[model samples]
Target: MIVADGIIELDNKNKAQGSGTAGSVLVLLSTYDSRVNDNNAIHLKNDGNSGVIYAGNGKIEVGNGNQIKEATGWKIKLKENTTVTYGQGMAGLFFTGPGGSYSLVKGTYQAK
Candidate 1:
């Protein structure tokens, strides 16, 4: 899905699945004030299949300011057989944000 210049609040959990055994979540944010916050309270889970989540933006001020932009309260759980892929051009997924905490419950990770 696309969030051009707005707010995407994932209150509980957000999910996406593919046709068979593969699926993906692609987020593209333009050079506007677009933000995605999970309140550092939810788990974005990709389970029982092959899936990828790619969120990219020219400007993502994660943890540079307010609580909404901070990754201090972020939680991402990749169950078995799931992967969160990151590209050389992408920035947010590779960094440890505020709270400076990340726990890998399960699954495999790679660079693409």
Candidate 2:
């Protein structure tokens, strides 16, 4: 449960009349041993400037060239047969129960 929060900028051509949306994004991620939950939180740079990789609650094993997050939620990393429950933010529940990556078996999206 890695909490990553920061702002992003959209640099489009002048032809576009409407401006882009920019704000803080809180991203929660975790991975195992490349078999179950194996991998980095995020490895890509498309459209983002500054942010923080909040790894406080749980143990955070990061890769190279990582950013600084706000560090809040727990950095959870479960192994084989490990089950995790996902809760809500401040309103409706997004994810709950075991699984990995993006999975929606019972017709419900486990919040990202």
Candidate 3:
């Protein structure tokens, strides 16, 4: 869980697998405010075989050149403006709940 304001970047040229209910490689459980164009990028990638990444939880406000690359099946509950770019043959899934507001910039958005 990310509980601070920072950047998360993941560029993989290999295979990485994650198993579980969420299959999440990164989970944001707090606020990642980049409203002022801090250039903070949240890049989560799993380009390898069976490499699935997920973005779960929190209020992630990524703007001002902040980029995000999320691959695999996820259960996301975003509370801010964010962009998620996924790999080929993969999609981004957003979970619905109370206080869950996700404004996706791009990617395959699946409702779960």
Candidate 4:
């Protein structure tokens, strides 16, 4: 997991790569903007699955030719030709704050 208070910039020169076994999730959480501006700049993979990127209070800009699993932010901008594959296994994954617990909502349980 990567938590940044400010901007998180990723380019060809500075990339974010992930490699590990299954269920090894990578989380990039940024309070500010997160920019990925290059081909193959960020390759986040866990076995055959991908990772997550979240910008809590800012925007997320993804350039072309990069592979990302899922991304969420206040605003998201994707340049032409970016690849995003959603992992079904991630649907059961949830993040919680300190001392938080899981709760049932609409017949489904999730972290709160």
Q: Give the candidate number with the greatest lDDT.
A: 4
Q: Locate the minimum summed-lDDT window of 10 residues in model 1.
A: 64-73
Q: Per-residue alpha-carbon lDDT of model 3 for 1-112, expressed as tens digits?
A: 4434455554543333344345344343323444445443344343432332332332222332223454322223222333455543233333334555556456665332
* Candidate 4 lDDT tens digits, 1-112: 7777766656543445455675566777776533443222222322222357777556777766666777877667776666788765655545434554566677665334
Candidate 3 TM-score, true structure as reference: 0.30
Residue 92 miss distance in model 2 (angstroms): 19
Query: Candidates ranked by TM-score, best first?
Result: 4, 3, 1, 2
Measure candidate 3: CA RMSD: 12.4
Ten consecutive residues with minimal summed lDDT in candidate 2? 9-18
Best by TM-score: 4
Name the TM-score of candidate 1. 0.26
Off by over 4 Å in 4: 33-50, 95-112
The estimated TM-scores of all candidates read 0.26, 0.23, 0.30, 0.62
Write down the TM-score for model 4. Answer: 0.62
Clashes of each: 1, 11, 1, 0
Which stretch of 10 consecutive residues in model 3 shows the poorest summed lDDT?
71-80
How many residue pairs in model 1 have overlapping backbones? Answer: 1
User: Compared with the true structure, what per-residue lDDT tens digits does model 1 show for residues 17-108?
Assistant: 33332323344233232234323222233232112222333223222111221122223333343334443333335465455545564565
Enumerate residue pairs that collide in model 4.
Answer: none
Provide the RMSD of all predictions against the true structure, rounded to 1 decimal: 14.1, 13.3, 12.4, 8.7
